[model samples]
Target chain A: MERIKPSLQLKDDIDLHISGWIVQRIGWVLLLLLLIAASLGVFGTGWLSAGHVAGKNGTVSFERIARFETPMKLVVQIEKADGDIEIRIPRSYLDCMEIDKIVPEPATQKAAGGSAIYTFDAEAESTITFYLMPESTGSIHTELTIDNTNFPIAHFIFP
Target chain B: MNPVVRGVAVYLFLLVVFRIMGKRSLSESTTFDFVLLLIISEVTQQALVGQDYSLTGAFILITTLISLDLIFSLIKEKFHLFGKIAEGVPLIVVDQGKPLTKRMRKCKVSEEDILEAARFHFGLEKMEQIRYAILEKDGSISIVPEKEKASIK
Candidate 1:
Protein backbone atom coordinates (compact mmCIF):
# COMPACT_ATOMS: atom_id res chain seq x y z
CA MET A 1 0.00 0.00 0.00
CA GLU A 2 1.25 3.47 -0.96
CA ARG A 3 0.29 6.67 0.80
CA ILE A 4 -0.93 9.49 -1.44
CA LYS A 5 1.04 12.73 -1.11
CA PRO A 6 -0.40 16.15 -1.87
CA SER A 7 1.78 17.90 -4.38
CA LEU A 8 1.25 20.44 -7.16
CA GLN A 9 4.63 20.81 -8.88
CA LEU A 10 3.21 23.56 -11.09
CA LYS A 11 2.56 26.38 -8.64
CA ASP A 12 0.81 26.09 -5.28
CA ASP A 13 0.50 29.05 -2.91
CA ILE A 14 -2.19 27.60 -0.62
CA ASP A 15 0.28 27.23 2.25
CA LEU A 16 1.51 30.85 1.90
CA HIS A 17 -1.95 32.44 1.47
CA ILE A 18 -1.85 34.10 4.89
CA SER A 19 -1.92 37.79 3.94
CA GLY A 20 -4.78 37.30 1.52
CA TRP A 21 -6.76 35.42 4.16
CA ILE A 22 -6.11 38.21 6.64
CA VAL A 23 -7.43 40.80 4.16
CA GLN A 24 -10.49 38.65 3.63
CA ARG A 25 -11.10 38.46 7.37
CA ILE A 26 -10.82 42.24 7.61
CA GLY A 27 -13.40 42.58 4.87
CA TRP A 28 -15.73 40.24 6.72
CA VAL A 29 -15.28 42.26 9.90
CA LEU A 30 -16.07 45.50 8.03
CA LEU A 31 -19.14 43.94 6.50
CA LEU A 32 -20.31 42.87 9.95
CA LEU A 33 -19.87 46.44 11.15
CA LEU A 34 -21.89 47.76 8.20
CA LEU A 35 -24.74 45.35 8.84
CA ILE A 36 -24.74 46.30 12.50
CA ALA A 37 -24.96 49.96 11.56
CA ALA A 38 -27.82 49.21 9.19
CA SER A 39 -29.71 47.29 11.85
CA LEU A 40 -29.32 50.23 14.20
CA GLY A 41 -31.06 52.55 11.68
CA VAL A 42 -28.14 54.05 9.77
CA PHE A 43 -29.66 53.04 6.45
CA GLY A 44 -33.27 53.85 7.49
CA THR A 45 -35.15 51.32 9.61
CA GLY A 46 -34.14 51.10 13.25
CA TRP A 47 -34.10 52.90 16.56
CA LEU A 48 -31.32 55.21 15.40
CA SER A 49 -33.46 56.66 12.62
CA ALA A 50 -36.22 57.62 15.05
CA GLY A 51 -35.85 61.26 16.21
CA HIS A 52 -37.77 63.37 18.68
CA VAL A 53 -38.20 67.10 19.09
CA ALA A 54 -39.81 68.22 22.34
CA GLY A 55 -41.22 71.68 22.17
CA LYS A 56 -42.91 73.59 24.97
CA ASN A 57 -46.43 72.76 23.81
CA GLY A 58 -45.78 69.27 22.45
CA THR A 59 -43.35 66.89 20.86
CA VAL A 60 -42.47 66.09 17.24
CA SER A 61 -41.19 62.66 16.25
CA PHE A 62 -39.99 61.70 12.76
CA GLU A 63 -37.50 59.53 10.87
CA ARG A 64 -34.04 61.04 10.91
CA ILE A 65 -32.83 58.82 8.08
CA ALA A 66 -34.91 57.86 5.04
CA ARG A 67 -34.56 56.61 1.50
CA PHE A 68 -35.63 58.51 -1.59
CA GLU A 69 -39.20 57.69 -2.68
CA THR A 70 -39.64 55.58 0.46
CA PRO A 71 -42.65 56.09 2.69
CA MET A 72 -42.17 57.46 6.22
CA LYS A 73 -44.09 59.08 9.05
CA LEU A 74 -43.98 62.37 11.00
CA VAL A 75 -45.85 62.45 14.26
CA VAL A 76 -46.84 65.55 16.21
CA GLN A 77 -48.29 65.21 19.67
CA ILE A 78 -50.07 68.26 21.01
CA GLU A 79 -49.63 68.42 24.78
CA LYS A 80 -51.92 71.47 25.26
CA ALA A 81 -54.54 72.53 22.78
CA ASP A 82 -56.72 75.63 23.34
CA GLY A 83 -59.44 75.20 20.71
CA ASP A 84 -57.75 74.35 17.38
CA ILE A 85 -54.22 73.00 16.74
CA GLU A 86 -52.55 75.15 14.11
CA ILE A 87 -49.68 73.26 12.54
CA ARG A 88 -47.39 75.17 10.18
CA ILE A 89 -44.42 73.86 8.17
CA PRO A 90 -42.22 75.61 5.62
CA ARG A 91 -43.15 74.99 2.00
CA SER A 92 -39.47 74.40 1.11
CA TYR A 93 -39.23 71.19 3.07
CA LEU A 94 -42.85 70.31 2.43
CA ASP A 95 -42.07 70.36 -1.27
CA CYS A 96 -39.28 67.86 -0.69
CA MET A 97 -41.81 65.27 0.48
CA GLU A 98 -45.16 64.18 -0.90
CA ILE A 99 -47.67 63.99 1.92
CA ASP A 100 -49.81 60.96 1.09
CA LYS A 101 -52.25 61.58 3.95
CA ILE A 102 -52.75 63.30 7.27
CA VAL A 103 -54.71 61.52 9.95
CA PRO A 104 -57.85 63.20 11.31
CA GLU A 105 -58.15 65.48 8.27
CA PRO A 106 -57.51 69.14 8.96
CA ALA A 107 -60.43 71.53 9.06
CA THR A 108 -58.53 74.13 7.04
CA GLN A 109 -55.44 73.94 4.80
CA LYS A 110 -53.71 76.86 3.14
CA ALA A 111 -50.32 78.25 2.15
CA ALA A 112 -49.35 81.47 3.89
CA GLY A 113 -46.03 83.23 4.38
CA GLY A 114 -44.09 80.39 2.71
CA SER A 115 -45.63 77.82 5.04
CA ALA A 116 -48.49 75.37 4.70
CA ILE A 117 -50.79 75.66 7.71
CA TYR A 118 -53.17 72.95 8.92
CA THR A 119 -55.85 73.76 11.51
CA PHE A 120 -57.11 70.73 13.37
CA ASP A 121 -59.88 70.65 15.96
CA ALA A 122 -58.37 69.49 19.17
CA GLU A 123 -59.02 68.93 22.88
CA ALA A 124 -56.48 68.95 25.72
CA GLU A 125 -54.14 66.57 23.82
CA SER A 126 -53.97 64.78 20.43
CA THR A 127 -51.53 63.25 17.97
CA ILE A 128 -51.26 64.04 14.25
CA THR A 129 -49.39 61.67 11.95
CA PHE A 130 -48.18 62.76 8.52
CA TYR A 131 -47.63 60.00 5.99
CA LEU A 132 -44.88 61.19 3.68
CA MET A 133 -42.82 59.84 0.82
CA PRO A 134 -39.58 61.62 0.22
CA GLU A 135 -39.51 63.08 -3.33
CA SER A 136 -35.88 64.25 -3.29
CA THR A 137 -32.63 62.73 -2.10
CA GLY A 138 -30.63 65.14 0.00
CA SER A 139 -30.58 67.02 3.24
CA ILE A 140 -33.99 68.51 4.16
CA HIS A 141 -34.19 71.49 6.55
CA THR A 142 -37.44 72.92 7.76
CA GLU A 143 -39.28 74.35 10.72
CA LEU A 144 -42.64 73.39 12.20
CA THR A 145 -44.90 75.55 14.36
CA ILE A 146 -47.47 73.89 16.57
CA ASP A 147 -49.52 76.49 18.38
CA ASN A 148 -46.77 79.10 18.69
CA THR A 149 -44.07 76.56 19.69
CA ASN A 150 -41.52 76.02 16.92
CA PHE A 151 -39.39 72.99 16.10
CA PRO A 152 -36.55 72.98 13.58
CA ILE A 153 -36.33 69.65 11.83
CA ALA A 154 -33.72 68.03 9.63
CA HIS A 155 -33.64 64.79 7.62
CA PHE A 156 -31.08 62.93 5.50
CA ILE A 157 -32.34 61.05 2.49
CA PHE A 158 -30.34 58.18 0.93
CA PRO A 159 -30.34 57.76 -2.82
CA MET B 1 -19.00 62.14 -9.53
CA ASN B 2 -20.18 60.91 -12.89
CA PRO B 3 -22.71 58.14 -13.39
CA VAL B 4 -19.75 55.92 -14.29
CA VAL B 5 -18.64 56.22 -10.69
CA ARG B 6 -21.80 54.40 -9.69
CA GLY B 7 -20.90 51.50 -11.97
CA VAL B 8 -17.32 51.35 -10.66
CA ALA B 9 -18.38 51.32 -7.03
CA VAL B 10 -20.96 48.58 -7.56
CA TYR B 11 -18.63 46.43 -9.68
CA LEU B 12 -15.76 46.68 -7.19
CA PHE B 13 -18.05 45.90 -4.29
CA LEU B 14 -19.44 42.83 -6.00
CA LEU B 15 -15.90 41.69 -6.91
CA VAL B 16 -14.72 41.87 -3.30
CA VAL B 17 -17.88 40.24 -2.01
CA PHE B 18 -17.72 37.34 -4.46
CA ARG B 19 -14.02 36.86 -3.87
CA ILE B 20 -14.54 36.62 -0.13
CA MET B 21 -17.41 34.19 -0.68
CA GLY B 22 -14.81 31.77 -2.20
CA LYS B 23 -14.38 30.26 -5.64
CA ARG B 24 -16.57 27.25 -4.88
CA SER B 25 -19.63 29.41 -4.24
CA LEU B 26 -19.51 30.94 -7.74
CA SER B 27 -18.87 27.61 -9.46
CA GLU B 28 -22.64 27.05 -9.65
CA SER B 29 -22.45 23.39 -8.71
CA THR B 30 -25.92 23.19 -7.16
CA THR B 31 -29.32 24.67 -7.98
CA PHE B 32 -29.21 26.92 -4.94
CA ASP B 33 -25.84 28.29 -6.08
CA PHE B 34 -27.30 29.34 -9.43
CA VAL B 35 -30.28 30.97 -7.71
CA LEU B 36 -28.01 32.83 -5.33
CA LEU B 37 -25.97 34.20 -8.22
CA LEU B 38 -29.16 35.40 -9.93
CA ILE B 39 -30.35 37.18 -6.80
CA ILE B 40 -27.01 38.93 -6.35
CA SER B 41 -27.04 40.23 -9.95
CA GLU B 42 -30.64 41.39 -9.61
CA VAL B 43 -29.77 43.31 -6.48
CA THR B 44 -26.77 44.86 -8.21
CA GLN B 45 -28.78 46.08 -11.21
CA GLN B 46 -30.43 48.89 -9.29
CA ALA B 47 -27.18 50.27 -7.93
CA LEU B 48 -25.44 49.86 -11.27
CA VAL B 49 -27.79 51.97 -13.32
CA GLY B 50 -29.24 54.04 -10.47
CA GLN B 51 -31.59 56.90 -11.46
CA ASP B 52 -29.98 57.26 -14.86
CA TYR B 53 -32.17 55.86 -17.61
CA SER B 54 -30.67 57.62 -20.55
CA LEU B 55 -28.57 56.01 -23.27
CA THR B 56 -25.53 57.86 -21.97
CA GLY B 57 -25.93 56.30 -18.56
CA ALA B 58 -26.26 52.84 -20.05
CA PHE B 59 -23.18 53.31 -22.22
CA ILE B 60 -21.21 54.74 -19.35
CA LEU B 61 -22.10 51.91 -16.98
CA ILE B 62 -21.39 49.21 -19.53
CA THR B 63 -18.06 50.75 -20.35
CA THR B 64 -17.24 51.15 -16.67
CA LEU B 65 -17.80 47.48 -15.90
CA ILE B 66 -15.94 46.30 -18.99
CA SER B 67 -13.04 48.61 -18.23
CA LEU B 68 -12.75 47.40 -14.67
CA ASP B 69 -12.75 43.79 -15.83
CA LEU B 70 -10.05 44.57 -18.38
CA ILE B 71 -7.94 46.25 -15.71
CA PHE B 72 -8.23 43.23 -13.43
CA SER B 73 -7.31 40.85 -16.21
CA LEU B 74 -4.32 42.98 -17.05
CA ILE B 75 -3.25 43.02 -13.42
CA LYS B 76 -3.51 39.25 -13.28
CA GLU B 77 -1.28 38.93 -16.32
CA LYS B 78 1.49 41.23 -15.03
CA PHE B 79 1.72 39.80 -11.49
CA HIS B 80 2.01 36.02 -10.96
CA LEU B 81 1.57 36.29 -7.19
CA PHE B 82 -1.57 38.39 -7.57
CA GLY B 83 -2.97 35.92 -10.07
CA LYS B 84 -2.36 33.01 -7.70
CA ILE B 85 -3.97 34.92 -4.83
CA ALA B 86 -6.94 36.00 -6.95
CA GLU B 87 -7.50 32.58 -8.54
CA GLY B 88 -6.31 29.56 -6.61
CA VAL B 89 -4.10 26.94 -8.28
CA PRO B 90 -5.35 23.48 -9.17
CA LEU B 91 -4.91 20.71 -6.52
CA ILE B 92 -4.17 17.01 -7.02
CA VAL B 93 -6.17 15.09 -4.40
CA VAL B 94 -5.18 11.61 -5.53
CA ASP B 95 -1.79 10.37 -6.71
CA GLN B 96 -1.28 7.02 -8.43
CA GLY B 97 -4.41 5.29 -7.03
CA LYS B 98 -3.96 6.59 -3.45
CA PRO B 99 -6.39 9.19 -2.05
CA LEU B 100 -4.69 12.17 -0.45
CA THR B 101 -6.98 12.67 2.51
CA LYS B 102 -5.29 15.81 3.86
CA ARG B 103 -5.37 17.66 0.53
CA MET B 104 -8.96 16.59 -0.15
CA ARG B 105 -10.05 17.75 3.31
CA LYS B 106 -8.32 21.07 2.97
CA CYS B 107 -10.04 21.66 -0.37
CA LYS B 108 -13.47 20.59 0.94
CA VAL B 109 -13.38 17.71 -1.53
CA SER B 110 -14.69 14.33 -0.44
CA GLU B 111 -13.91 10.76 -1.51
CA GLU B 112 -17.43 10.38 -2.88
CA ASP B 113 -16.95 13.47 -5.00
CA ILE B 114 -13.75 12.07 -6.49
CA LEU B 115 -15.33 8.68 -7.32
CA GLU B 116 -18.33 10.43 -8.80
CA ALA B 117 -16.11 12.45 -11.09
CA ALA B 118 -14.20 9.29 -11.96
CA ARG B 119 -17.34 7.35 -12.86
CA PHE B 120 -18.81 10.25 -14.74
CA HIS B 121 -15.68 10.94 -16.77
CA PHE B 122 -13.89 7.57 -17.06
CA GLY B 123 -16.42 4.88 -15.97
CA LEU B 124 -14.08 3.77 -13.14
CA GLU B 125 -15.95 2.22 -10.19
CA LYS B 126 -13.30 2.25 -7.47
CA MET B 127 -10.59 4.53 -6.06
CA GLU B 128 -7.87 2.10 -7.25
CA GLN B 129 -8.86 2.79 -10.83
CA ILE B 130 -8.30 6.51 -10.32
CA ARG B 131 -4.66 7.32 -10.99
CA TYR B 132 -5.09 11.05 -10.44
CA ALA B 133 -7.99 13.11 -9.13
CA ILE B 134 -7.39 16.78 -9.66
CA LEU B 135 -9.50 19.50 -8.05
CA GLU B 136 -9.47 22.32 -10.53
CA LYS B 137 -9.45 25.96 -9.50
CA ASP B 138 -13.01 26.19 -10.77
CA GLY B 139 -14.09 23.62 -8.14
CA SER B 140 -14.52 20.72 -10.54
CA ILE B 141 -12.89 17.30 -10.06
CA SER B 142 -11.01 15.71 -12.95
CA ILE B 143 -10.22 11.99 -12.91
CA VAL B 144 -7.41 10.17 -14.74
CA PRO B 145 -8.01 6.44 -15.29
CA GLU B 146 -5.28 4.10 -14.02
CA LYS B 147 -5.50 1.63 -16.93
CA GLU B 148 -4.54 4.25 -19.54
CA LYS B 149 -2.36 6.30 -17.17
CA ALA B 150 -0.16 3.30 -16.40
CA SER B 151 0.73 2.93 -20.10
CA ILE B 152 1.49 6.64 -20.65
CA LYS B 153 5.05 7.95 -20.45
Candidate 2:
Protein backbone atom coordinates (compact mmCIF):
# COMPACT_ATOMS: atom_id res chain seq x y z
CA MET A 1 0.00 0.00 0.00
CA GLU A 2 1.27 3.45 -0.95
CA ARG A 3 0.67 6.54 1.20
CA ILE A 4 -0.78 9.60 -0.62
CA LYS A 5 -0.10 13.25 0.23
CA PRO A 6 -2.32 16.20 -0.75
CA SER A 7 0.13 18.79 -2.05
CA LEU A 8 -0.69 22.48 -1.68
CA GLN A 9 0.04 24.80 -4.60
CA LEU A 10 1.72 28.21 -4.05
CA LYS A 11 -0.02 29.67 -7.13
CA ASP A 12 -3.39 28.73 -5.67
CA ASP A 13 -2.60 30.58 -2.44
CA ILE A 14 -1.61 33.77 -4.33
CA ASP A 15 -4.76 33.60 -6.48
CA LEU A 16 -7.00 33.24 -3.42
CA HIS A 17 -5.33 36.25 -1.78
CA ILE A 18 -5.81 38.44 -4.86
CA SER A 19 -9.41 37.30 -5.31
CA GLY A 20 -10.15 38.14 -1.68
CA TRP A 21 -8.64 41.61 -2.06
CA ILE A 22 -10.58 42.47 -5.21
CA VAL A 23 -13.97 40.75 -4.85
CA GLN A 24 -14.48 40.89 -1.09
CA ARG A 25 -12.69 43.99 0.18
CA ILE A 26 -11.86 46.59 -2.51
CA GLY A 27 -14.69 45.68 -4.87
CA TRP A 28 -17.36 46.06 -2.19
CA VAL A 29 -16.00 49.40 -0.96
CA LEU A 30 -15.87 50.89 -4.47
CA LEU A 31 -19.40 49.73 -5.29
CA LEU A 32 -20.79 51.38 -2.17
CA LEU A 33 -19.09 54.64 -3.19
CA LEU A 34 -20.55 54.44 -6.70
CA LEU A 35 -24.14 53.89 -5.54
CA ILE A 36 -23.90 56.95 -3.31
CA ALA A 37 -22.11 59.19 -5.83
CA ALA A 38 -24.43 58.29 -8.70
CA SER A 39 -27.51 58.81 -6.52
CA LEU A 40 -26.38 62.38 -5.88
CA GLY A 41 -24.48 63.30 -9.06
CA VAL A 42 -24.14 62.36 -12.74
CA PHE A 43 -23.93 58.55 -12.27
CA GLY A 44 -27.18 58.83 -10.31
CA THR A 45 -29.01 60.10 -13.39
CA GLY A 46 -28.96 56.65 -15.04
CA TRP A 47 -30.11 54.91 -11.84
CA LEU A 48 -33.15 56.89 -10.67
CA SER A 49 -36.68 56.54 -12.10
CA ALA A 50 -38.19 59.55 -13.96
CA GLY A 51 -41.35 61.13 -12.50
CA HIS A 52 -43.20 61.84 -15.80
CA VAL A 53 -44.30 58.21 -16.06
CA ALA A 54 -46.14 58.35 -12.75
CA GLY A 55 -49.63 59.81 -11.93
CA LYS A 56 -52.42 60.68 -14.36
CA ASN A 57 -54.63 63.57 -15.55
CA GLY A 58 -51.72 65.96 -16.24
CA THR A 59 -50.59 68.32 -19.01
CA VAL A 60 -47.88 67.50 -21.61
CA SER A 61 -45.21 69.73 -23.21
CA PHE A 62 -43.72 69.36 -26.71
CA GLU A 63 -41.62 71.52 -29.07
CA ARG A 64 -40.51 70.93 -32.64
CA ILE A 65 -39.27 73.45 -35.28
CA ALA A 66 -40.12 72.68 -38.90
CA ARG A 67 -37.46 73.04 -41.62
CA PHE A 68 -37.21 71.42 -45.09
CA GLU A 69 -38.92 68.53 -46.93
CA THR A 70 -40.25 66.43 -44.03
CA PRO A 71 -43.30 67.80 -42.23
CA MET A 72 -43.71 67.10 -38.49
CA LYS A 73 -46.56 65.08 -36.92
CA LEU A 74 -48.27 66.75 -33.96
CA VAL A 75 -49.46 64.34 -31.27
CA VAL A 76 -51.11 65.74 -28.15
CA GLN A 77 -52.32 64.22 -24.90
CA ILE A 78 -54.47 66.30 -22.49
CA GLU A 79 -55.69 65.03 -19.12
CA LYS A 80 -57.73 66.34 -16.19
CA ALA A 81 -58.79 65.32 -12.65
CA ASP A 82 -62.51 66.14 -12.73
CA GLY A 83 -65.38 64.45 -14.63
CA ASP A 84 -64.91 65.80 -18.19
CA ILE A 85 -62.20 67.93 -19.81
CA GLU A 86 -62.60 69.69 -23.13
CA ILE A 87 -59.89 70.21 -25.82
CA ARG A 88 -59.97 72.48 -28.89
CA ILE A 89 -57.36 71.43 -31.52
CA PRO A 90 -56.79 74.37 -33.86
CA ARG A 91 -56.85 73.60 -37.64
CA SER A 92 -53.44 75.31 -37.97
CA TYR A 93 -51.90 72.35 -36.10
CA LEU A 94 -52.88 69.95 -38.91
CA ASP A 95 -53.84 69.81 -42.57
CA CYS A 96 -57.55 68.94 -42.02
CA MET A 97 -58.27 68.91 -45.79
CA GLU A 98 -55.81 66.03 -46.37
CA ILE A 99 -56.88 64.11 -43.22
CA ASP A 100 -58.34 60.58 -43.63
CA LYS A 101 -59.66 58.92 -40.49
CA ILE A 102 -62.81 57.59 -38.77
CA VAL A 103 -64.20 60.96 -37.74
CA PRO A 104 -66.37 61.01 -34.62
CA GLU A 105 -70.02 61.74 -35.54
CA PRO A 106 -70.89 63.86 -32.48
CA ALA A 107 -67.68 65.96 -32.63
CA THR A 108 -68.41 69.71 -32.68
CA GLN A 109 -66.49 72.05 -34.98
CA LYS A 110 -66.44 75.86 -35.00
CA ALA A 111 -64.72 78.25 -37.40
CA ALA A 112 -62.23 80.66 -35.79
CA GLY A 113 -60.87 83.14 -38.37
CA GLY A 114 -59.07 81.27 -41.21
CA SER A 115 -58.56 78.25 -38.81
CA ALA A 116 -61.18 75.94 -37.25
CA ILE A 117 -61.23 74.55 -33.65
CA TYR A 118 -62.26 70.90 -33.27
CA THR A 119 -63.97 70.35 -29.91
CA PHE A 120 -64.04 67.03 -27.99
CA ASP A 121 -64.85 66.04 -24.39
CA ALA A 122 -62.76 63.47 -22.48
CA GLU A 123 -63.39 61.57 -19.24
CA ALA A 124 -62.10 63.70 -16.37
CA GLU A 125 -60.98 60.84 -14.11
CA SER A 126 -58.70 59.26 -16.78
CA THR A 127 -56.09 60.77 -19.11
CA ILE A 128 -57.15 61.49 -22.72
CA THR A 129 -54.56 61.86 -25.51
CA PHE A 130 -55.36 62.14 -29.22
CA TYR A 131 -53.47 62.25 -32.52
CA LEU A 132 -53.77 65.11 -35.04
CA MET A 133 -54.02 64.48 -38.77
CA PRO A 134 -51.78 64.98 -41.86
CA GLU A 135 -49.44 63.06 -39.52
CA SER A 136 -46.72 65.48 -40.65
CA THR A 137 -46.86 69.21 -41.35
CA GLY A 138 -45.74 72.40 -39.61
CA SER A 139 -44.50 72.28 -36.00
CA ILE A 140 -47.30 72.72 -33.44
CA HIS A 141 -47.26 73.95 -29.85
CA THR A 142 -50.35 73.06 -27.82
CA GLU A 143 -50.31 74.69 -24.39
CA LEU A 144 -52.73 72.97 -22.00
CA THR A 145 -53.34 76.18 -20.06
CA ILE A 146 -56.57 75.00 -18.48
CA ASP A 147 -58.23 77.02 -15.63
CA ASN A 148 -57.64 74.71 -12.63
CA THR A 149 -54.41 75.83 -10.91
CA ASN A 150 -53.30 72.46 -9.49
CA PHE A 151 -52.73 70.38 -12.67
CA PRO A 152 -49.34 71.19 -14.21
CA ILE A 153 -48.01 70.04 -17.57
CA ALA A 154 -45.51 67.18 -17.58
CA HIS A 155 -42.73 67.82 -20.10
CA PHE A 156 -41.29 64.94 -22.13
CA ILE A 157 -39.36 64.51 -25.39
CA PHE A 158 -39.21 61.69 -27.96
CA PRO A 159 -36.05 61.32 -30.02
CA MET B 1 -19.20 74.72 -15.16
CA ASN B 2 -18.40 73.19 -18.53
CA PRO B 3 -20.91 70.32 -18.83
CA VAL B 4 -18.55 68.20 -20.94
CA VAL B 5 -15.60 68.25 -18.53
CA ARG B 6 -17.84 67.77 -15.50
CA GLY B 7 -19.60 64.93 -17.27
CA VAL B 8 -16.36 63.12 -18.14
CA ALA B 9 -14.84 63.40 -14.64
CA VAL B 10 -18.05 62.29 -12.97
CA TYR B 11 -18.52 59.44 -15.43
CA LEU B 12 -14.95 58.17 -15.07
CA PHE B 13 -15.08 58.11 -11.25
CA LEU B 14 -18.41 56.27 -11.29
CA LEU B 15 -17.12 53.73 -13.79
CA VAL B 16 -14.24 52.85 -11.46
CA VAL B 17 -16.40 52.89 -8.31
CA PHE B 18 -19.15 50.68 -9.76
CA ARG B 19 -16.62 48.21 -11.15
CA ILE B 20 -15.16 47.84 -7.66
CA MET B 21 -18.64 47.24 -6.13
CA GLY B 22 -18.60 43.79 -7.74
CA LYS B 23 -21.65 41.85 -9.03
CA ARG B 24 -23.04 41.00 -5.58
CA SER B 25 -23.97 44.60 -4.71
CA LEU B 26 -26.18 44.72 -7.81
CA SER B 27 -27.65 41.32 -6.96
CA GLU B 28 -28.80 40.87 -3.32
CA SER B 29 -27.72 44.13 -1.71
CA THR B 30 -29.15 45.06 1.70
CA THR B 31 -29.71 48.50 3.24
CA PHE B 32 -26.21 48.57 4.75
CA ASP B 33 -24.75 47.94 1.30
CA PHE B 34 -26.62 50.98 0.00
CA VAL B 35 -25.21 53.22 2.74
CA LEU B 36 -21.65 52.15 1.99
CA LEU B 37 -22.32 52.89 -1.68
CA LEU B 38 -23.57 56.37 -0.82
CA ILE B 39 -20.48 57.26 1.21
CA ILE B 40 -18.11 56.13 -1.57
CA SER B 41 -19.88 58.37 -4.07
CA GLU B 42 -19.76 61.36 -1.74
CA VAL B 43 -16.02 60.97 -1.31
CA THR B 44 -15.37 60.49 -5.01
CA GLN B 45 -17.61 63.44 -5.95
CA GLN B 46 -15.44 65.82 -3.95
CA ALA B 47 -12.35 64.48 -5.72
CA LEU B 48 -13.78 64.45 -9.25
CA VAL B 49 -15.57 67.83 -9.22
CA GLY B 50 -15.31 71.08 -7.30
CA GLN B 51 -13.07 74.08 -6.47
CA ASP B 52 -10.57 71.92 -4.55
CA TYR B 53 -10.38 69.30 -7.30
CA SER B 54 -7.10 69.18 -9.23
CA LEU B 55 -6.33 67.70 -12.65
CA THR B 56 -3.33 65.81 -11.27
CA GLY B 57 -5.36 64.36 -8.38
CA ALA B 58 -8.18 63.09 -10.63
CA PHE B 59 -5.68 61.71 -13.14
CA ILE B 60 -3.79 59.80 -10.45
CA LEU B 61 -6.96 58.35 -8.92
CA ILE B 62 -8.46 57.27 -12.24
CA THR B 63 -5.20 55.87 -13.57
CA THR B 64 -4.54 53.81 -10.43
CA LEU B 65 -8.06 52.36 -10.56
CA ILE B 66 -7.87 51.51 -14.27
CA SER B 67 -4.43 49.95 -13.93
CA LEU B 68 -5.45 47.76 -10.98
CA ASP B 69 -8.55 46.54 -12.77
CA LEU B 70 -6.71 45.81 -16.00
CA ILE B 71 -3.97 43.89 -14.18
CA PHE B 72 -6.47 41.89 -12.16
CA SER B 73 -8.56 41.02 -15.21
CA LEU B 74 -5.53 40.01 -17.26
CA ILE B 75 -4.18 37.78 -14.47
CA LYS B 76 -7.59 36.25 -13.86
CA GLU B 77 -7.99 35.44 -17.57
CA LYS B 78 -4.52 34.22 -18.49
CA PHE B 79 -3.96 31.71 -15.67
CA HIS B 80 -6.12 29.56 -13.39
CA LEU B 81 -3.89 30.51 -10.43
CA PHE B 82 -4.42 34.22 -11.18
CA GLY B 83 -8.16 33.67 -11.54
CA LYS B 84 -8.33 32.01 -8.15
CA ILE B 85 -6.24 34.82 -6.73
CA ALA B 86 -8.67 37.32 -8.20
CA GLU B 87 -11.74 35.33 -7.14
CA GLY B 88 -11.97 33.32 -3.97
CA VAL B 89 -12.67 29.59 -4.17
CA PRO B 90 -15.73 28.00 -2.62
CA LEU B 91 -15.29 26.75 0.91
CA ILE B 92 -16.66 23.30 1.69
CA VAL B 93 -18.66 23.40 4.89
CA VAL B 94 -20.14 19.94 4.78
CA ASP B 95 -18.89 16.62 3.35
CA GLN B 96 -20.27 13.11 3.68
CA GLY B 97 -23.01 14.26 6.09
CA LYS B 98 -20.49 15.86 8.48
CA PRO B 99 -20.00 19.56 9.09
CA LEU B 100 -16.52 21.00 8.68
CA THR B 101 -16.42 22.92 11.98
CA LYS B 102 -13.18 24.74 11.14
CA ARG B 103 -14.32 26.07 7.77
CA MET B 104 -17.71 27.04 9.18
CA ARG B 105 -16.14 29.13 11.96
CA LYS B 106 -13.72 30.77 9.50
CA CYS B 107 -16.66 31.83 7.31
CA LYS B 108 -18.52 33.21 10.37
CA VAL B 109 -21.39 30.85 9.64
CA SER B 110 -22.93 29.13 12.63
CA GLU B 111 -24.12 25.53 12.64
CA GLU B 112 -27.70 26.77 12.70
CA ASP B 113 -27.24 28.76 9.47
CA ILE B 114 -25.66 25.77 7.76
CA LEU B 115 -28.53 23.56 8.96
CA GLU B 116 -31.13 26.10 7.84
CA ALA B 117 -29.63 26.40 4.36
CA ALA B 118 -29.34 22.66 4.06
CA ARG B 119 -32.89 22.08 5.30
CA PHE B 120 -34.30 24.71 2.96
CA HIS B 121 -32.32 23.54 -0.06
CA PHE B 122 -32.51 19.74 0.46
CA GLY B 123 -35.68 19.49 2.54
CA LEU B 124 -33.41 17.96 5.10
CA GLU B 125 -34.28 18.05 8.78
CA LYS B 126 -30.71 17.26 9.81
CA MET B 127 -27.17 17.87 8.50
CA GLU B 128 -26.86 14.12 8.04
CA GLN B 129 -29.45 14.30 5.29
CA ILE B 130 -27.07 16.41 3.17
CA ARG B 131 -24.37 14.79 1.03
CA TYR B 132 -22.42 18.03 0.56
CA ALA B 133 -22.72 21.72 1.37
CA ILE B 134 -20.52 24.52 0.05
CA LEU B 135 -20.34 28.22 0.80
CA GLU B 136 -19.87 29.72 -2.65
CA LYS B 137 -17.69 32.71 -3.60
CA ASP B 138 -20.83 34.80 -4.18
CA GLY B 139 -21.99 34.32 -0.55
CA SER B 140 -24.62 31.76 -1.50
CA ILE B 141 -25.09 28.28 -0.07
CA SER B 142 -24.95 25.29 -2.41
CA ILE B 143 -26.11 21.85 -1.29
CA VAL B 144 -26.12 18.28 -2.56
CA PRO B 145 -28.90 16.20 -1.08
CA GLU B 146 -28.46 12.62 0.01
CA LYS B 147 -29.79 9.97 -2.39
CA GLU B 148 -32.02 12.28 -4.48
CA LYS B 149 -32.60 9.44 -6.98
CA ALA B 150 -33.81 7.15 -4.21
CA SER B 151 -36.29 9.76 -3.00
CA ILE B 152 -37.54 10.38 -6.56
CA LYS B 153 -38.09 6.71 -7.26
Question: Distance from true position, residue B113, model 2, in Å?
Answer: 2.7
Compute each candidate's TM-score over C-alphas: 0.76, 0.34
Model 1 agreement with the true structure over A31-70: per-residue lDDT tens digits: 8999999999998868999989998889999999999877
Q: Give the alpha carbon lDDT tens digit for every residue of A35-64 in model 2.
A: 685565322123231223222545443223
Error of 1 at B37 (Å): 2.0
lDDT of 2 by residue, B1-153 (tens): 332345456665565454354433433436876787788779757645444366766676567666667766887788976555334566666766778775565455567767777767766777777776766667667777778532653
Residue pairs clashing, model 1: none
Predicted model with the maximum lDDT? 1
Q: Model 2, which residues run further than 4 Å from truth?
A: A1-159, B1-71, B148-153
* Overall lDDT per candidate, in order of appearance: 0.81, 0.49
Error of 2 at B5 (Å): 15
Task: Evaluate residue A57 in candidate 2 and report its C-alpha lDDT on the 0 to 100 scale.
Answer: 45
